[model samples]
Target: MHPALSIIVFTTLSGLGYGLATALGTGLLDPAATATKAAHLLALALIAAGLMSSTLHLGNPQRAWRAFSQWRSSWLSREGVMAVLTFLPLAASAFLAIFESRYEPALGLAGAALSLVTVYCTAMIYASLKSVQTWHTPLTPLCYLLFALAGGFSLSTFFAAMGGGNLLLSSGLAAFFVCLAWIAKLVWRNRMNTLRPISTPETATGLGFIGKVRLFERPHINDNYLTNEMGFRVARKHAVKLAALSFGLGGIVPVALLLGLLALGAAHPAVAVGVALLAVLSHITGMLVERWLFFAEARHAVMNYYGG
Candidate 1:
């Protein structure tokens, strides 16, 4: 449950990338505009950067290619396979937008669908892990999808404010998605806080019937791989503070700014652009904290043996 910097960056950046890809597929912007070109490039850049960061978490980055071969059984494999397949259509769509200044419905839509599916696959990588009770839930994928949509919409609002499309509508949609994402996140937090341990030392050792179980001594004199990776702990107080920051910055503040942008109604393009920029920055920062807490707080079932 250690929060690896590489994985955190991978998830956040890729979510935003896929979200933007989804929006672009809807033909939301004028393909001929400079903003459209910039948006297309940015989307691909974000996705590529995220995918590359993910490789950093692997023990043998060169063997990452083998991951694609296990799509039938592994969520990670499915994610890898889908991520590669997604690029074909996304590249074609980007090429059309950048070079031809036109949107191809077939390619754009295909890329968009694949982008979402890829996100789902990424979520399933964690959601499918039964050993991590915090992550083993339907809500895991739901939260991931919603956060991606929210981030993507927020980024789209910035492009829209820059004159690539309808600023008012984009801001409104961004606000709505941010609100919805936070609501789902709030529920997730509540569940995590209230969850009873499905796995404890007694259950882990199959000794509950004998009576309460407790660790009589340390597993060893020194830490091992499992302790280093899965025995992480966070103070309840710090968690409360971080969760508040995540909600306020990632959710509340962005919504306020987005709604303000909606009210501005294209009256002041420069001000709207600045506000959108702030909203985007704040949301990204908030999401980073949330992701950090996500790993820091997770209780891996394997930790039971380590007296965690």
Candidate 2:
């Protein structure tokens, strides 16, 4: 499982965008406030950017539209469909906030629900893969959803601080979600560390009775698509270091910043904004490392035949 930059960007940006949309949908921010408007615009931009980046992974970007037709059977297709459908309510909510300067509770709620559903669909695209044991767990979607909320809260805190809203409440919310996100991630990593693969070379070949199966020769003299994509290997030591870094930057740092802001209480607007911005930046950077690890750490069952 090679970590593709396109998919990493898609997941990170879209998750944050949808997270912010979810907050807005739930009336976490005042619709008429300038901060709300900025948040909405940022959400839309992130979503658009993420959706577009996904096409880069396709063999034919122009034909990506065909993916929408398989929603009945494919999680990827479902994600595509939901992502598009989510835009309707999201756009309406944004329009109402910008023009009417009023929050339509119903539309906002619907948008929030749809935004979460879209992120869930995205997570399912990976979680539903039976071949990837690490991702084939309920925790996959849990981690995705929690991280999105955490990132969203962090961003909202920044917006609130800059827009002269109640920093205490927003920062508190951010801290809560950050804690949940880290907890979920820690559980996910634990599962990955201990879970046994249902597939092994011996089991895959139906020759376990013979015992101690091993690959004596390369499948080919040179690398092929399968080897290049599914046979990627990461050193255990490097993984440990990256995981620690991810936890620190993505989870610990953001939580500390939020809690610090809360403790400081009515600090200068510039100082508050700077702290919130740093939290947002650090969280995003941490998420990038985590996403890379998500792909890099996975051992596709197909690799079993290749002695992975």
Candidate 3:
């Protein structure tokens, strides 16, 4: 459950890239506009950066390609395959939008669908682990999808404002998605707060009927891989502060800014774009903190054996 920087960057960057692609694919932005070309290029850049970051987390980066062959039985493999597959349509859509200045509806839609499915596969890689009760809920995928949409829409608002396109619509949609993502996140957190631990030392040892089980000695004289990886702990007080920070910066601030921009109604394009850019920055920063917490707060079932 240790929070690896590589994976954190991968999820956040890739989610944003795919979300932006989805917005473009769904016709939220005009394909013929110069801004659309910039957006397409930006999306590809984010996706490529994220994909590269993931390889750094592997034991053997050169051998990572072998992961693609396990798609039938592994969510990780499915994610790997889907991530590669998604590039086809996304690249095609980008080419047409950039060079031809034309939006092929079918290709765009296909790319969007594949992008979302790849995100789903990423979520499932964590959610399917029965040992991690916190991530085993349906809310995991929902959170991932909603956050992607929220981040994507926020970025789109910035592009629209800068491009002098439909600022009102883009900002409005961004605000709505931000609110929804925060609500869903609050619900998920509340559930985790109240849910009983499904695995305890006594339960793990199948000796609950005898008496309370307690650790009498260290598993080893020193820390091992399992302890370092699965036995991560965070202070409850720190978690509370971080959660507040995440909600305020990622959700509430973006909503307020976008709504304020919408209310101003036809403000100078430069001012609107500036505010949109601020919102995008705040949201991405908040998401990074939230993702850090996501990994840090998890308690692996294997930890029960080690007196976690």
Local distance difference test, candidate 3: 0.89
Give candidate 1's whole-model lDDT: 0.90
What does candidate 2's lDDT look like per residue over 45-124, in tens digits?
A: 99999999999989888888899999999999999999999999999998988887778899999999999999999999
Q: Please give each candidate's TM-score.
A: 0.98, 0.97, 0.97
Error of 1 at 289 (Å): 0.7
Q: Is candidate 1 or candidate 3 better by lDDT?
A: 1
* Tens-place lDDT digits, model 3, residues 1-308: 88889999999999999888887787777777898889999988998898999899888889898999999999999999999999999999999989998889999999989989988998999999989898989999899998988998898888888682778988898999999988889998998788898999999988889999887787688989998887778634389899889898999898999998899766688889889999999999999989988888888899888888
Decreasing lDDT order of the candidates: 2, 1, 3
| C-alpha positional error of residue 91 in candidate 2 after TM-score superposition, expressed in Å | 0.9
Query: Which portions of model 3 show Cα errors greater than 4 Å?
Result: 235-237
User: What lDDT does each candidate get?
Assistant: 0.90, 0.90, 0.89
CA lDDT, candidate 2, residue 120: 95
